[model samples]
Target: MTENGAQLFARLETRPCLKDIEPQLFPEGGGPNHGEVVELYGTEGTGKTEMLYHLLCRCVLPVATGGLEVDVVFVDTDYSLDMLRLVSILESRLNAGSSSSAESDEAALRLCLSRLLVVHCSSSSQLLLTLHFLETSLSSRPGLALLLIDSISAFYWLDRCEGGASAIRQEEKLRKCAELLGRLLSDYRITVFTTCHAIKKVYNGPSSGSGYDRPYLCRPWQRLVTHRLLCSRQETNSVAPSAGGSEEQSRRQVFTVHCTSSGSRTKAYRSSSFCVTDGGVKFI
Candidate 1:
């Protein structure tokens, strides 16, 4: 039976999308819904991946302890899955939120860690294969709500060079991968989040302006992106003190999220600020 637009949206809206992280970014009673793809793009060292880890931790932590308690599947394409780092952040968050005993906290942390399934892929082909086989796991894990890929453009330059004077083959490979990912999103009720490099615009002038950084994924995957979150860094003013001390300055990231939905207003923009400390992404 084919579901109509209203019915589909009703179902999608029931699921959550980083609601705990920043509920204000979403509509009333809604976050990143199921079957939607969200892209986080930024230059190197912009804390894009760190932000994703924060979202993942929110998903896997128990609801009783201030977490969504949903399962997450994280596919690491750039060797960016730092388990120790994630655990550190998780421990900090759990400790801060929970008044449970030490043994109970440790048990909850272990349970949350088990819910996050991590996969590593070194190449694009391997990525495709990983997505293809993920269906079984997705089916088995009914609580799963988010699927993440750390920088889907991990092989951008390599794939371009491998094309050898032709870009069609490279585009086709990415297109096929996007198709598979889309099918998975449609078949299951999960929100997809992926990071991509920001392609610098080659404009004739000093490169300091808005809308200069564009997503680098191929056209197919680009079309799948329902929400685009641009991450950038801003240095704190010397007059303002950081968490460390009154004399210390720190850098924070600003995320500007743009919704691609047709009904959205022209200037409907949402922004959030956060910093990545040893604990993890701290929303400010």
Candidate 2:
């Protein structure tokens, strides 16, 4: 079903793939299949957080502006949320326009604020339990619209996996986590936005730090995400020195969305220069 209880993209229904539908640059409804398991992956700080915050603002927007007048459920496992930043994005929308529409937007904003809920977690087990509780909570109150799990990979113990024999155990652990997440997706039709760490490995044989390439997501988990995206950062100071672009060109972040399994998938790509301001990510 389409996000608003509409019959679309389901069995026996004809619908185009997300990539085929050109993504609206700054709008929330621009993307495809909202109430599905969609994953956003990147190394670190490549606008995943920013995009998520922007989405939060959009949910508060009135229906006139292509936004669903609904609520947001943010599950912050990494404690990466910034409250002031949230208010900034909400206020920016109100300030963007004036007249009767602005008044309506403000009203919608207030209502959404009342409905919004956040759950913070320090451990993977807590995160899982909280989500289970959320499922029960939402059934009682159906207005809890979208559910976002920021940085799912952060829950795992990153440094614990060294090499050789230990790698097998790590994979098994990862596989189990993926299984749990998959079950949740099937049970709930909420839009699941998860931020993942894209692993990268280098061959240290003869070429030191050379032949570096992008790595895929973990297997079973990868299959669960119907729509997957990669957020690549611009050539910032932390990035490689020869990371492309000119002297005057400011760094740009990439948002590339694709599908899971085989077949042709839509590649809705976006590359824009942005920075983290007091108001979160601002497109430059």
TM-scores of the candidates are 0.83, 0.66
lDDT of 1 by residue, 34-148 (tens): 6777788887777789888988887898887678888889999999788899999899988985688999989989999988888999888899899888887866566777899
**C-alpha lDDT (0 to 100) for residue 152 of candidate 1:** 90
Q: Assess the local accuracy of residue 189 in candidate 1 as a C-alpha lDDT between 0 and 100.
A: 63
Clashing pairs in 2: 19-266
After TM-score superposition, the amount by which residue 48's alpha carbon in candidate 1 deviates from its true location, in angstroms, is 0.6
